[model samples]
Target: MLFRLALAMGRTLQELRATLTYAEFQEWCLYYQIEPWGEDRADLRAGIVASTIANYAGKLRAEGSDPALPADFMPYLERPEPADPSDDRHLTDDELAAWADAAIFGIPPE
Candidate 1:
């Protein structure tokens, strides 16, 4: 749901990149009541942050600057797999977003 919400927010993938600090993002997630909070959630945020850092690093490299990812960040380079579109049970974007919003804000879709 976070993935879908982020994608819906903007065009560039960088926009979805975890720009906030882990602590800040975690707080936001908690406020939204994102589920399964613990190391798994922490790891998700970390991956987002690391991916953003890597994106910038790549851009910098292209611009003739040297950048390197730390060992911890390296492991997170591979992103989590998106849901398979062929799955019969997967909700459409509108449905998913509506559900997510209702879950987070207690406001159902019109």
Candidate 2:
């Protein structure tokens, strides 16, 4: 899911994972109307919203008006520094794998 989002947003996976805070990532997903967990028919809803946006853009272009995107359409390029710089340490491989499992599979970290 993150891979697909990265492609759609023209951002690198590392950027998504390391740069954005969890809250920012959630906001980005909400902007795209994609539910990261694929729950509650969210995928279908996102598709409908995307189709609607595309059709609207096409209509605008047909009328000789270029549609402008919202100013806050994209996620922030950088997150603010943590209060404690030491809190910015990189995750270990095992920790990363655990987080991936939790995010992708809904398996709570042990």
Candidate 3:
């Protein structure tokens, strides 16, 4: 999802000039993959999403933007743990979408 968000940023800047909806963003990911296969694997897909979050957060810190969230947030975002039946709750899709919005648009989640 985070990768999709970052791709959406690129799409906004280089092509679409408009934000893509979630399904559109998913399609973009599948199309852009080198092999363009096995996107159905939830684990691999989650890893992709988490890495994109890390990349975006790193970019922000490298550029010295106001760090909207905490420094440790990315680690949690990138962790590979299964969200199901865990004591540590994971962010929901809507929450992640808001985070992506913040990364892309420089606004805090409401």
Candidate 4:
């Protein structure tokens, strides 16, 4: 979502970091299938985070910059962050394993 945030909101990485709350930032990382910090995060939160990141990354790569994106997407659109459409998402086995470990019953090493 960093790239998307940069495209739509025109914010730098640092700016984007500052914009998102603790939870939002974590969610962003999780959305990308990147390793989240700890076991503290709930399964649902991690899933949402992973999805949001994945979706945003896909959007940025596929669509490039958003011409219609406002200068400050957060202000214009209460929550500029996109939803994670994981229904049809293709996650790698390693990724699925981590999510499963954290989300599902058994835990797997990230």
Residue lDDT tens for model 4, 1-110: 46654555567878877777878855665654554333233444555566566666666574665433222322222232675777677879988787676543334455
TM-score of 3: 0.24
Candidate 2 residue-wise lDDT, 65-103, digit = tens: 555343213232123354776677788999999877765
What is the TM-score of each predicted model, taking all chains together? 0.27, 0.28, 0.24, 0.23
Relative to the unseen true structure, what is the C-alpha lDDT of residue 36 in candidate 1, on a scale of 0 to 100? 47
Superposed by TM-score, candidate 2 places the C-alpha of residue 76 at a distance from the truth, in angstroms, of 33
RMSD of 1: 15.9
How would you encode candidate 3's per-residue C-alpha lDDT over 1-110 as one tens digit per residue? 44444544554443542555668766765664533333233445666666667767677465755433333333333434445675676789999999876644335688
Judging by lDDT against the true structure, name the best candidate. 2
Which one wins on TM-score? 2
- Please report, in order, the local distance difference test score of every candidate based on alpha carbons: 0.59, 0.60, 0.54, 0.54
Q: Could you tell me the lDDT of residue 39 within candidate 3?
A: 29
The TM-score of candidate 2 is 0.28
Instruction: Show pairs that collide, candidate 2.
Output: none
The global Cα lDDT (0 to 1) of model 3 is 0.54
Clashing pairs in 1: none
Worst ten in a row by lDDT for model 4: 69-78
Determine which window of 10 residues in candidate 2 has minimal summed lDDT: 70-79
